[model samples]
Target: MAIAAASTSSFPHLNHTLFPKCPSLSHHYHFRPLRVPFTVRASSAVVLERDSITQPQVTSKVELFACPVCFEPLIRKGPPGFNLPAIYRSGFKCATCNKTYSSKNIYLDLTITAGTKDYTESQPARTELFRSPLVSFLYERGWRQNFNRSGFPGPDEEFNMAQEFFKPSEGGVLVDVSCGSGLFSRKFAKSGTYSKVVALDFSENMLRQCYDFIKNDDTILATNLALVRADVSRLPFASGSIDAVHAGAALHCWPSPSNAIAEINRILRSGGVFVGTTFLRVSSTTPEILRPFIRQRVSQSYSYFTQEEIEDLCSTCGLINYTSKVQQSFIMFTAQKP
Candidate 1:
């Protein structure tokens, strides 16, 4: 990518302390000093210097995040690198919408209603339950373990299965949609399989809980991982920019599964992969008589889908190569963007 160099006057918010002072130029005639900026671009880092005499200040430009409202690339100001600390200190702004998004506590808020104060909306019970602070704290501690009763196979096995499905997307960007408490996001980042991993969710407390688990782990913190607050139905990414999307046990909780899946397809590249896990309404072992009752009861809270329905949904959303593995109520499915 070409690096566009411009005068510091354009970005008035840039801290002068971040750069070094230029050497004095002495001449016979008295004239106004010209402040020229030099930028050195690299694959991993970008350095900006005010003058040749001073040391260049290294900073990283954020290009992965986009405006949730306008679907435009966000401009970033502040520190370099993709680490947690660098991202925390950075601020993102959308040029098209003239909207600014900043880090709330630790995670960046990129939702359409991120800055809204008077307009409060409530999500369905299934989505709002995870937003509670208490529930967010217990998600990985004990809540997720309950899935074993329904044949979840545990997190270690699930992570391995997802990894196998995501092999084609190696060295690419991965987004963990609805990543409550980031149980799988940390693993994906540590594996070094993807160039970057985004842990995205709508719950504020869930993101805070994710940061709590990551703050003490230097190994995972140093990876190219980002925590963002965004709605699943309206993903914040440019068209065909994402390589892989993983929603572990999250599809059933979405307000609208069709809208969410379509949004996922919109963000994925032509050959990108999407892997997700959710609870099926009724497994093969379920009694024929009880199937209807189970479906009715679950439909009141979460939108559990049958295996066939899931395949149909993926196909309808422009995804191909549909396949799945089922064990009792638990199901892991995969689809590719064509």
Candidate 2:
């Protein structure tokens, strides 16, 4: 029962969780799972080739990101290589305080800790299961399967809904918080709707998988896409600098959901939107037999929220125009900063 430690630095060494000591990377697994319903095809497709259709303009907007600890703008330093051209994507350091950060593959490591504090020791312990490259491999390979466990709209549908919710017009900056394997971020980047689609996650291995999927496949320019390793509780961005945020099925994983929500509210500009999905508490409509199973499945790391709780959290953050859809255990929400 070795739970996963949560996810690392530079050209800094990778923490164990991010790059767990695995036996080999030789194993191959199919990305699609076997049991998806007929109505839904595998949500993820082959990694498409990079196209310069919608790369973001990096030179004009480097001041968007701030140092997590010092709250100063971060400037690109050193050589370039993470997805974007050398001009836009490179190692980062604080402009004023002079603090520096590193990367694991394309993911710019920003958090001192790989993630926010784990809610319970067991929570991280269970996550340890993800440390193995094999586990990561399986998870990414079968993302659609795990995602479909609740039997709702698939990723493609959710992507469309998110586009409608955020309405990412030109020059908008959208951050995909806790983007696992770039499933949703890639779609947003390719759509060319937003000026930039940043894929931020704490797991180096997860980001590595994303880079592996996209590096040679697509022509997405460096300016349009970025990979950052950061904590949701402590995002590395200036206040009110972001236009929208998306976190799919990731809120329950945060140690401090309240803190994370507040941070999301903090970074969003007035009228900016936050759209994401999560698990909710068992509903009255749920069959009696399944309640125990669901309860047993929820570990300490994952906090199940009710519709009321979700709305409460959003309202407390001063977010308006809140809307959500609940079906059994799955919940999707969109809110706007006032």
- The 10-residue segment with the lowest total lDDT in model 1: 23-32
Residue lDDT tens for model 2, 273-295: 99978877776478878766764
Per-residue lDDT over 185-301 for candidate 1, one digit per residue giving the tens place of the 0 to 100 score: 999999999999999999999999998898778788889998999999989898899999999999999999999999999999998999999999888689888766764636688
> Cα lDDT of model 1 overall?
0.81
Highest lDDT among the candidates is held by which one?
Answer: 1
The CA root-mean-square deviation of candidate 1, after full C-alpha superposition on the true structure, stands at 8.6
Give TM-scores for every candidate, taking all chains together and pairing residue i with residue i.
0.84, 0.72
